[model samples]
Every structure is written in C-alpha cells, then in structure tokens.
Target: MTTSTGQPLAAQRILVTGGAGTIGSHVVDLLLEADAAEVVVLDNFARGRMENLAEAEAVGGDRLTVVTGDINDPALVRDVISGIDVVFHLAALRITQCAEQPRLALESLVDGTFTVIEAAVAADVKKVITSSSASVYGLAESFPTTERHHPYNNDTFYGAAKAFNEGMLRSFHAMNGLDYVALRYFNVYGPRMDTHGLYTEVLIRWMERISRGEAPLIFGDGAATMDFVHVRDIARANLLAARADVTDTVYNIATSTETSLKGLADALLAVMDSDLKAVHGPERAVNGVTRRLADISAAARDLGWTPEIGLSDGLDDLVTWWRHAAQPAVAG
Candidate 1:
C-alpha cells in the first residue's frame, strides 16, 4: 500500500509505542499508508534501531514524528498520548531475551504495559491496541488454541508478564472507560526482524545459517509447532483494530496454522536453494506445555482481520531482504 505525497495519515493522530521495532515499524508503515493525520513513534532505542525510524519518516513525510523515550516513563508516555486518536503499543522485551533478564522483563512488559494504559486513559486516547503474545498459552493441549483456552502455566517470565498485563487491560476497561484491544500475536516473521548476535529470532537464525552453507540447529524433537504470522498481516490487524469501533477486548492475531521446526528447516532450505539439513543439538529443557497455534475465528468475526501471508511467502520476503541487507555495500 502506498500513501499520497503528503497527508498520508489524513487527520487522525496515531501514536505507535515502540514504533521502531520489527513489528512496530510495520505498524507505523501501515498506519501511514492509510493516511492517518499524524504518526507519533515512541521508542527508547534500547532494542530498536534508528534506521527503523528513518524508514517510517521517509514514508510518512511530515506525518511521522519520533519520540526517543522509554515507555516506562509515565510523563513521556502521557505526553505522547495526549491528543492522539489511537495508540498501538508494541513495546516490550521479547521472549528469549526476557527469559535471560526476568526482572527487566517484568519491568518492561508488565510495568510498561500498565504505564501505557494509564497514560492512554489519562490522555483520553480513543483507542488502544497493545501487542500481546501467543506465549500466554504456554503449552496448549489442543492443536489450534482459541482465546478461550485455559490460562497458561507461564513457563517463562515473559509469558507471565503478558498474562499479568492482560489482566490489567481487563481491569482498566472495566473500571475506566478506556477502550483497548490486546492482540496475541503468533510467531511473527518479516522484514526488519531482529538479527542481532545471540538475539536473533529462530527463523532469522535458521536463514542466516543456511545462507552461510551451514546446517541449521534444532533442539528437542523439532516437533513443537508455532503459528507463524507475517508482520505485514499484523500491521493490517493493528490498523483494523484502531479503526474498528469496539470495546476493550483481546484477539489472537496469527496465521491459524502450525509449522514445526522440521518443516521450517525444510522451507528455509528450499528458499536458500541449498541441500544442507538440520543438525540436532543439545535440546534446552524448557518448562511448559508444548504445541501452539491460534484459533483466530474471533479476530475474523470482530475485527474483520485475518492474516493472508503464508509462511513460505513471508519467509521468502524475509530471506530476500536479509540477504540484500547482509551484503557489504548495503551494510555501509
């Protein structure tokens, strides 16, 4: 989707908390593509890149504004929320990294969420859509986990934080008049996803190893599955949530299909045009029930949003971008 030369955002002032990360940047892009009046990006640059902001600004023209700040800062969050029509809060420490730093995870995920909701309510923002995660469902006994699934065992601090935040969202919606939407995103992969050393996403790690003619590493039985949804589809869902007139609610934003690690390895090999296979490594023991996929029927019915990008197509785009971005000329 392309925005007009100017006035891409038409008139609504949309604030994207953590707007410079992988998923958040795409949300900013889609919001601008819809021609919102203004797109305010709030980021601390702790885990986000400057280029993500630059990309948003380039496409947003004058509509994009970057606030280099932390979400935990109530003052800054309130200031950004003031006069904004909608808030897409996508800021948080990720799952793997949060596991290593449990305390920081709680601060950023749980406390930061409370901060955003409070600020949004204070600013009287019309709508708020915070990013949730499928991790909230720890291990699903069923194949396609629905929103009605039993509360998670909370295998990690990250998942526990999300669970706590979901409770907070419900509380805010009930007591205050804050309209909110919590989207439980599945395994998201697309362009601009994190590939930092030892902090890369699983799909990204697989792609990088395959690019270097190395066999991808797999832990456990490689049978555990995840419903991988593309960031573009997630971006569209965020826009839909903001535009739709709805009360506080939660929805699973995912492709509604399960892809196991073995399958993912095969897909990557096909993408890279390589014959290297996956090598089983020492499986890190993780607590929690396994098997996860999203039952997104509620999302389709309520938000009129469904992820259209398939894993293969999404991974293809991601690998292509990664390959180009990995080149020396492109790097500097």
Candidate 2:
C-alpha cells in the first residue's frame, strides 16, 4: 500500500490503542494502506465492536492484528508496546459520557494514559501520537481556537483528564526523551462510527434518526458551532505525525473552520436527501460548545498535514456507507 504522497510505510510496526473505534479504525486503515509492516489494533471493546476490527483486517489482510486489551493494564500495555515502533493512543471515554461517569473516564483517560506512557518509556518505543480533545479548550475565549489556549477551565472532567494526559506526555518527552505528539482533535466523524446508543457521535445519531423516519433533535437553538473534520483526514495526520519532525510538543489536528449545529443538520439532510425537520430539544445536562475552529498553521508547518476533504464531500461518502451499513452484514 502507498500513502497519498506515494511513500511506503512497510518498515514501521504500528499499534493503535483504540484501533477498533470510529477514529482509531480509520487510523488503522490509513496505517495499513500506507504499507505498514504490522498494524496492531489494541482495544477493550467497551465502545468499539469486533466488526470494525474485522473490516480493517479484511481490507489489509495479513498486515493487521487485533489485540483485545485495556490501556489501563500496565503489564498488557507494556507487552503490546515492547515490539512496536509507533503508538497511536486514541482510547478515552466520550465527553458527555465522561460527564456522567467521571471516575471511569479518569481511570481510562488519566491512569490508563500514564500506563501507556510508562510502558512506552520502558519499551523504548520510537514515537507516540495521542488524541486530545478540543473540549480541552472549553468555552473558547476567542473564535478559531489555537493550541495556545490555557488548560481546560473548570469544565467537564473529560476535558480535564485529556489536559492532564497531554501534560504528562509532554513531561515524559522532555524528561525521559519519549518522542510524542498530542493531537488536539476537534469534532471527528466518518463511517464505522457508532450510531445506535448513547455513545454515538452527533452526525451519526442525526443520520440514524433520519434513517428511522424520525426527526432528529436539536439542542441549544442549533446555533452552537463545532469543528467537524473527517476521520480520514485525522488518519492521514496520525500517519504524518508518526514520521513528522517533532521538536514541538503538540499540534492541533483540525481545519481552521467552524460548523454550527444547524449547518450540520442542513448538510446531513441534503446528503441524505431528506426533508425531515429537526425538533428543538431541551438542553440536556451536557454543556454545549459555543465555537470550535482549530489553528492548523502549526499542524501544517510541523506535521506537513492538513485536511483536504471538506464536510460536504466527506458526508457524501459517510452517508453512503451508513445507508449500506444499515443492511445485514456480509460474511467476511
């Protein structure tokens, strides 16, 4: 397999912690397609399903390996990291879910992260690319959020845990010479995303509701702005970051653009060819983000990575996949 740049990645042994997840599976796809020597999918299956792993394996054939494990288990993480050259850490409890189960979120995002880093250090892994949320920015003081934003305000515990894990990674890199990149991800969406239950992404949920002949609910007057980047773009960035010149500590993995909730509905409806009106729902316990747009100048300069797929084009692909995904599974 060749990267978009036509470079082969067959020399690298890569491990993605949440490799069966929506974003992580895409990362695995990019890694294996780019010709990675081995692509290990390390996931606990808490939120991710085995079918996702099988899909990637089916595409990449012998290049992909699935490992069922938790990042919090130090011994298991150490064993997994022992022979890997690069690690992409994407495991975490979701934002709203974390708000409900703060303790579990902390255990996965914080303690689990510490275990990953310590194992990397002990194994002398070459590089680690971690996923940090734009939620860490909280209610942005400025439009177009940058990497320079101060650590999370007293917002959700999920963001706080991401903040702490990022800080820890930086500290390890500085003190222990553990090469690392922390990617502050804005809203990421694409195919294989969970759309059934409480953990589904907003776009997937809306698509599911529309598919079910039901109107989707819009909270907060549908004015809340979010930065939606395609999962493939993020997967490209992870591969780029794996080999990118990394004197810097972190990079914001996003397009410097914002999308409102209404904009999202409009895009989805147009993509799905549906006229279903969205009903405004009561604002739930989860706090809404006012604005989210990344300052990707640093990502471009540092990782040589920037998103190329716009939301409209990506949605066309995503909706097609979702529609077909609604059908019964085909045997592998």
Residues 1-332, candidate 2, lDDT per residue (tens digit)?
72221223567888899998888998887887777889888899888887676667788888888889999999899888888888899988888788888888888889999999999889888888899888788888876667887864538888888889888987997899788888988888887777664666677777767877777778768888888898889888888887776733778887787888988898888888888888888876567567787888988987789899999999998898888774422211
In angstroms, how far off is 129's CA in candidate 1?
0.3
Each prediction's total of clashing residue pairs, residues at least 3 apart in sequence or on different chains, is: 7, 0
Can you tell me which runs of candidate 1 are displaced by over 4 Å? 1-10, 286-289, 326-332
lDDT scores of the candidates, listed in order: 0.81, 0.81
* lDDT (Cα, 0-100) at 289 in candidate 1: 48
lDDT of 1 by residue, 130-160 (tens): 8888888888777678888766555778878
- Give all candidate RMSDs, comma-separated: 4.9, 4.5
Cα lDDT of candidate 2 equals 0.81
TM-score of each: 0.92, 0.92
